[model samples]
Target: MPFGKVPVLEIDGKVLNQSTAITRYLSKKAGLAGSDDWESLLIDIAVDNIHDLRQEIASYFYDPNEVTREAKYAPLINETIPFYMDKFEKTVEENNGYFVNGKLSWADLFFVAILSYLNSSVKIDLLEGRPKLRALKEQVLAVPQIKAWVAKRPTDIP
Candidate 1:
């Protein structure tokens, strides 16, 4: 609870925090993680990048000043989002619609998680000019289990 975060997990009497770590652990448990060290490393890289992107978005959300928020929004719309999203789209395309090595790693799941938050919280269609990312989003959300989870979740953004 250092940052008062809610992703704190209790596994086998051991406590763990941080979303990325928790996700990684669960992904491995569910057989959704990478198949080898190299692939796992790639997944880590992708997850870290997503974390930074989410932080940038969070900074804008937490800013109380309209002028500052607007200033940040412009770059996010025209630069930051495109830069990250474009790279993500390319990676997904190269990996056959997945984030890592043509397989379903935690990277793909993290992409969807952050993508959904960005869509709802920022209310921006970040996927507008990115066809691959759009397709990836559709693919991720179409998973039977993910679809069921989304359907039962609250409608509110936050």
Candidate 2:
């Protein structure tokens, strides 16, 4: 409620706001943040990049005017998405299917978690043709904890 946001987390009578801050805090507690400062920095970089791309997609997805939306979609689908996705693909390949430290980090989880929302907004599989990214997604979702959650998560959203 600090920023009137729905994602605020109440912990031990204290409130935490902002999705990134909350995710980072939880990642640290969950052992998914990173192994060290350098690794954490790398994870932060990847997460920030993904967030930037998500904002771009949301801009196009939320536009009210059809004409402007179509105009925005052209460059977004043809250029922006490919540009960011290609970079992500190469990064995942270099890291051996993870976003940072060549192992599971919050960045990987964050990317995989938001991917469905992103795809839904665009109506296309962003991972299509990006084998490394697709594989990363599979790897994250295959985690026992995440898989179990996915099985029970709400399916009402398209």
Candidate 3:
């Protein structure tokens, strides 16, 4: 708990903080990180953008006052969501349904992870206007492991 965070991973007796770093480490170990450096770079970019979107949603979650939350939600729904969703839609379209290189990578998994949180927190369908994003979600969900996990995952939101 170097940062007092829950996602700290203990791998080989080495503690790793930061969810993204832990994910990259484990994904690489599982051969789901990326095939090569360039693919990894692409995945990095996509993951960063996805995190940016998540941050916007997190702002809404952490606001203590209704006035502040409502104020934040407007710009989030109007500007931030649209901007990132459009970019992600384009990236998914260019990457052949996957988030990168037409293959399943950590980037796709990251999006799927955040997608659920975003879905439960918001009233609107975040991917309503983004067909490619919808397809990307479907593609990620189709993975047998992910499908099984989600079927039993808790319905809690944060």
Top model number, TM-score: 2
- Work out the TM-score per prediction: 0.88, 0.96, 0.88
Q: Which 10-residue span in candidate 2 carries the lowest summed lDDT?
A: 149-158
Instruction: For candidate 1, write residues 67-93 as lDDT tens digits.
Output: 998789888877888898889888888
What tens-digit string does per-residue lDDT give for candidate 2 at 1-158? 88787799999999889999999999999999988999999999999999999999999999999999999998999999999999999999999889986899999999998998999999999999999999998899899999998899889843
Give the lDDT of residue 18 in candidate 3: 86
lDDT of each: 0.83, 0.93, 0.85
Clash count for candidate 1 is 0
Error of 1 at 148 (Å): 2.1
Cα RMSD (angstroms) for every candidate in the order listed:
2.0, 1.1, 2.0
Candidate 1's C-alpha runs over 4 A off are 1-4
By lDDT, the best candidate is 2
Worst 10 residues of 1 by lDDT: 113-122
Give residue 40's lDDT in candidate 3 (0 to 100).
Answer: 85
RMSD of 3: 2.0
